[model samples]
Target: MKFSAERATLLKALAHIQSVAEKRNTIPILANVLIHAADGQLSLKATDMEIEVVEVIPATIKREGATTAPAAVLYEIVRKLPDNVLVELDQADGDTPLQLRADRYATRLNVLSVDDFPSMGAGELPCRFKLNAGVLRSLIDRTRFAISTEETRYYLNGIFFHAADADGVPLLRAVATDGHRLARVETDLPEGAAEMPGVIIPRKTVAELRKLIDEAPEEIEVALSETRVQFTAGSIMLTSKLIDGTFPEYDRVIPRNNNRILRVGKKDFSDAVARVAAISQERSRPVKLTLEPGLLTLSASSPEQGVAKEELDDNRISYDAESLEIGFQARYLNDITDQVEKEVEFAFSDSAAPTIVRDVDSPSALYVLMPMRV
Candidate 1:
């Protein structure tokens, strides 16, 4: 294959493709990216058996051919090349090493058989829709922090996406949980997604997709089947195998009658929690919340680090519920609060029951946190 592409353009495409290739692989071809040059464009493809990413960039084609080259090595070479320099790639045949040249620098990368690369095809995607990039970003950013990292539960390792009805209006929802905390966010359902089946997108796929969409166009195309999902953003296309498992009915865990309400500024609450939790040396970093009609106290204690406490009065907090004390991991509380805007609302039933939290300005997103012993 022979082609010449601008360094900036080629480097951007390689950065997206090379990340899909696994750093360690048993198969030789799986560690390489398939490079094809034809019809005034260069297509780069890389996969790790489960997720595949392909990106096409405009290039000056000298010959119509294809070959495989080490993805990481090629990416590094292009990245180091001077900006605005034109990168040239050439290979006589599949048996010959690929030559890369840019200005005064030149290198040869060992080639692999392009026929050996596996393809994870998006088979018969029946459900197709379009979503605004900003909306999609909101759904992922608010919920992904709660995705489970536990391997045994496999089913809980990704965000659950499906169509549901809120009152009489249909909405698309993303829910994630790790048994201790849960995040649920929803947006208005788009056209052609009413009959879509619920799917669990793997954690890795969610992360990769999020990165690509950061600078994507205003609108993103989405197509999915029961077993696979595909996202198309401009010149980049990603196909991933969905996790085949049933997500638990998450609604049962959300608190319904936690009538004791507390409204506080997000900055004040987060800052107070951070200060008190800094004194703890435990892995969980437990912080206690002592609440009264018009005051809230945050405290933490450790055998080696001693005790720390901070208080917020009625001026910064509005609470009229009976006095209550509850404990929670400082890290988990921070994760949920990071998504909130100006103010945070907390509903409590007792010291031991699950607590409901929400952003006072964003009604479409909700969170649930389980209390711990202080």
Candidate 2:
């Protein structure tokens, strides 16, 4: 196999594909990246059996062939090469090492048979759609913070993605929860997404997909099946296996009649909660929120440390019930409020009931926080 590509082009392709290869693997070939040179393009593929990423870059090909090389080692070498330099790869035989040459540096990287690399065949994807990069990023950033980290309840360790109707209009929804708090966000369903099945995308896949969308492409192509999903951004493609588990029915956990309303600036509420929680214990870090007609006070106390209290004037705050005091983990509040824009509205039924938080300007996202007994 022989191919030549620009330093920058090869580096970018390697950066995207090498991350899918696990650093430590029991199988030797699993830690290697498969490189195929054919028809004026160089294709790089890496996988950990569960998730696979492939990137193709335009290259000048003198011979059509394929080889496997250590992914991390090759990435490091390419990253340190001089800018704009042309990199040349040559493998004379199938069993011999691959020769890598760039300017004055020359090295022979060990090679494995390309046939040993696992094949993640492209299955028939029944559902295909196109979504704007900005929309996909918003849906992930707004709800990923609430995804559960517990491995026992694997179903809760990812964001539940599905199509649902809100007020007679169809929308695509993403929901994640860790029992303490829940985040739900919705966006307009893409044209071809009506038949998309509800899938629980694993946390790792969500993180990787987030990286691809961070640069903000104009649009992303998504193909989905019952057990897997594939995302294509330009010349790069990511394929991941869906988590085989049923997600809990999250609608029941959302409060329906919590009418006690309190509207406050998102920044102010977040800042006050952080300040009060500073004196809280390391374990629980519980902060108390006291609501009244026109004032909201946040307080936190620790027997071993000290107490903190802060009061904010909220003209929109209103509650018919006697002054209600509720306790919650301060970190959870910050996580929810940080994702909100402009003002945040809170609805509560009682001290023991769950509190619902929403952004006044954007009703598509909602958060539910279960109160703690302090």
Candidate 3:
């Protein structure tokens, strides 16, 4: 393959592609990126079996050919090259090393057989839709923090995406949970997405997708099947295999009739929780909340570190519920509250039952936290 591409453009594309390639792989080809040059464009592709990313950029093509080279090495070389300098890549055949040249720097990267690079064939994607980049970012940012890191319950290790009806209105929803806490966010369903099947987008895919969309254009094209999903953002295309497992019926865990409503300033509550939690040395980092008419008290205790407490009065909080004390992991509380802006509403059932939380400003998003015994 032979092509010349601008250093800045090539480096940006390589940054996205190399992240998908595994640094250490039993199959050597899996650690390399497939570089194809043809038709006035250069296509770079990398995959780690479960996820694949491809980026195309305008390049001066001298010959139409393809080869595989170390993805990390290529990215580093181009990234360190002088800015705005044109980068030239050339290879005579699959057996020869790929030559990389800039203004004054040159290096040869060992090439692998392009035929050995695996492709994650996107079978038939029946459901397709277009979502605004801002909306997609909102969906991921609000819920991904709750995605499970536990390996045994693979089903809970991703965000569950599906179409649902909220009061006869079709809505696209994203839900994630790690057993201790759950986050659910929804938006108006996009066109052509009403019949899409429920799918669990793996954590890694969500993370990579989030990074790409940060610089993506205003709109993103999404296509999905029962087993796979693909996202297209301008010249970058990402295809990932859906986690083959059934997510639990999450609605059953959401408390509906909590009735005891407590509203507090987001900053005040978060800061108090952080301060009190600093005293607890356990992994759970338990923080206890004591609630009463017009007042809320936050406290945490450790046998070795002593105890800490903070109080928010009616001025900063509004609570008319009868006396109630609830225990929760401080980190989990912060994670849910971080998504809220201005004020946070807490609906409590009892100290023993799950507590419902929401952003007073956004009705489309809801959270449930399982109380930790303090």
Candidate 4:
């Protein structure tokens, strides 16, 4: 196989696909990326069994053939090559190593037969839809932080994506939770996605998709089936097997009648929480929020480190309760506030009930945090 490609173009494609290949592999072929040169294009593929990424870039093909080489090594070689130079890859015989040549560099990398590469299965998708890249990016960003890292409750390890009705209006929603906290974001349903099945997009797949759509690609084509989900944008396609599990009914946990509403500046609340929690126990990092008619105070204490406290402007906050004190992990408070750009509304029933947090202006995104016992 022989082909030539521009240094910058080739490097970008290789850099993105190589990340899918694991460095230490029980199976040798898993460490190599499949390179196929044909039809005036070079296709690079890398997979770690669960997720696969395929990228195609325009290249000059002198011979149509395929081979596999160490993904990381090839990427480094292409990245270090002089910009704008043409990189040539040649393999004259089936038993010969792949030859790479740049302006002043030349080397042969051991190659594995392309037939050894794992096959990516993308079943026929009954639901295919097109969504604006910006919209999809927003949905993922809002909920990804709450995805569970726990391995036992595998269902919560990724974002739960499905179609739901919000106030009689159909909307596409992404929900994630780790028991202690939950995040839910919703957007208008894309055309042709009415029947899309609920799917748990694995954490790794969500991360890869985030990278691909970060540049704000104009539109993304999404195809979904019972077992897998595929996304295509520009010259790249990512396919992954969905987690086979049922997500709990999270709506039941979202507080609906917690009317003790308190509005506070997001930055103020976040900073206060961080300061008070500085003296909190290492294990829990617990911060207590004490709310009253016209004052809100945050405090934390550790037997060995003493205690810390902070008081915010009562004018910016409002609460209907006579008085209530709730405890939460300081890190969780920071995470929920980091996603908000303006004021935050905290709705609580009592010190022992789950507190609901929301951006005052963004009704589409909501966070539910269970109180930590102090």
Candidate 5:
């Protein structure tokens, strides 16, 4: 089989697909990328079993054939070739060794048998729909920071996505938490999404797919099966297996009937938290917030370092009692507010109960921070 293609086109396809190939794998085939040349299009596919990506590009195919070669090496070689140089790929005797050439740069890369490559087969996707790429990007961007990295509680390691009520109507929701902080965001439920099962997409898969979706076209087609989900956008496709575990029912954990409410500028809260957290020790980095009437005071102290307090002027704290003090991981609070587009509303009952924060007019997204003992 032989194919000739512009260096830039081949490099782009390889770059798109090679990111999904595992750098080091126990099985060598997992590190190899499958190259298929047919018609006037060329396809490069790679997978790490859990996540797979395939990129398609237009090429001049003189002979139709498929072969597997080291994904990293091929990507690096093509990246170094001249921009418009044409690359030609062919097999010497249709055997295990493949010939690769592009002008002065040529190499014979050892090929893995195509029979050993594992391709995921679609299993009758019960639920499918179209999601706007921009909306999907917003959901991921605003909440990914709160996803748990603790492997022990694997159930909380990804965004918990489901259908829920938003202002008494049906809506699609995504929630992520790491015990200390929680991020919840929602969008109008798209048609045909009510019956879909809630899936916990792993963090690694989410990050990899994020890059693909960033450059994807405006609309993306999503198909979800019992165990896996596939996104087809433009000339690329990504398939990933959902994490197999029960996501914690976080509804009960969210406090209800909180009486204290404080409305303040999102920027002010974030900056105050950031400055106070700087002096906090690494291990128990807690910032104490004192709310009383119209005053909001942030303070933090470390055993080796003295206490520091910063007063925020002209804020709205609807409490008149002795200051209601709440301690929290300053970084968590800052992360939740950093994405806020406008003012923030902080809800609380007492210092011990969890506090919920949200944009003034947008209830679609909510953030919860569990209080820490300072």
Candidate 6:
């Protein structure tokens, strides 16, 4: 479309939307970004069929028109241009190729008919509410790391968002897990989200939204149905279909009465896990947790290598019951504790039962990790 926009603004918008377009496409038009202009505003849209991103920017719409061009090439060229340059798109010379002009630098990119681009389905979006950017960021960062990359369990491939009863009070929760470990974090239910159905946000969208949250948009408008979900923040909007499958019932696996408690400094625990787990095999880095009256012991060993034992002071570590030795994938334990902001508490039912780690203050955020038989 014929429009003029700030070089930096154009570059940012292009970078955001173009990521949704896959590098290699089975269809030619799938690699091109659809450009639309009207009312002095330009919109850039790119889709890989499953996900679609639309970015709008303020521009001088000299002529209202629509066209498509390679998303990657245009993004790179615009990104490399001089700072503060005003980019102008012109199609008035009776040439189908749109001329990108910025000061002395210019390029004529062959444009395709916008009609061939896939049309994004914008359903009747009603449910929406504003949540703090800080809250959204917290929900994603804490849980996204545990999302499964395994293609077999497609249902666990994204973070689960839904309303649930936490501490006997209504709350909105986000959960993600592979088979080894799981993260469950919840926040107070936002207004207009009381009846929102649970949806599994795809992994790609989880990552993309993390980048956009830096804008600190006022309202994170969310809309979802049984099959699809959409999020609108700042001048960008993302839409994607929900994963069509049933997520495993994770609550039953959460150890409810894990009475054995050990309070340890998060940083110290993470460091010990990192050092000891290195010597163990990648597949079975089962770091054993041995709790005594006043000490917390972390030990690991391998047949190929020797063994290691680290004793740390945990003032509250009092386990009168039989000495419990719970084994866990040290890396998984580290992932759950690395992002935690403060003191970390590990609770266990037994050496064989599931072990849970939680913040000493934040009851809403909990991690359930399966134990290994060492």
All candidates' lDDT scores?
0.94, 0.90, 0.94, 0.90, 0.84, 0.85
Report the C-alpha lDDT of model 1 over 165-260, residue by residue, as the tens digit.
988999999999999999999999999999999999999999999999897999999999999999999999999999999999999999899999
**Tens-digit lDDT track of model 4 for 256-348:** 889888999988888888778878558577898888888898999988989898887567677657688889988898889988988999999
Clashing pairs in 1: none
Q: Candidate 6: misplaced stretches above 4 Å? A: 93-95, 280-284, 314-322
Query: Which digits, one per residue and each the tens of the lDDT, describe model 5 over residues 1-374?
Result: 78888888788788878888988878899899998889789888999998999888998888898999999999998898887888999885446588889998888999988889998765688898888999888888878999998999998888877778756888888888888878888998888888888988889878987888878999888889768888898999888888898988788778888768888888777877877787856846889989887788999987777788988766433445455888988877888888787788888888889999888877778888899986
Candidates 4 and 5 compared by TM-score, better number? 4
lDDT of 6 by residue, 222-280 (tens): 88787788888878988987888888898988978988887777887888888877776
Candidate 5, residue 126: Cα displacement in angstroms equals 1.7
Q: Please report, as a residue range, the 10-residue window in candidate 5 with the lowest summed lDDT.
A: 314-323
> What's every prediction's RMSD, in angstroms?
0.7, 1.7, 0.8, 1.3, 2.1, 2.0
Residue 216 accuracy (lDDT) in model 6: 46
lDDT of 3 by residue, 1-374 (tens): 78999999999999999998998878788899999999999999999999999999999999999999999989988888888899999998879999999998988989888888898999999999999999999999999999999999999999999999988999999999999999999999999999999999999999999999988999999999999999999999999999999999999999878999999999999999999998866768789999999999999999898999999999999999899988999999999999999999999999899999999999999999999887
Spell out the clash pairs found in candidate 4.
none
The residue pairs found clashing in candidate 3 are none
lDDT of 1 at 127: 98
Clashing pairs in 2: none
**TM-score to native of every candidate shown:** 0.99, 0.95, 0.99, 0.97, 0.93, 0.94
Which stretches in model 2 have alpha-carbon errors above 4 Å? 281-283, 315-322
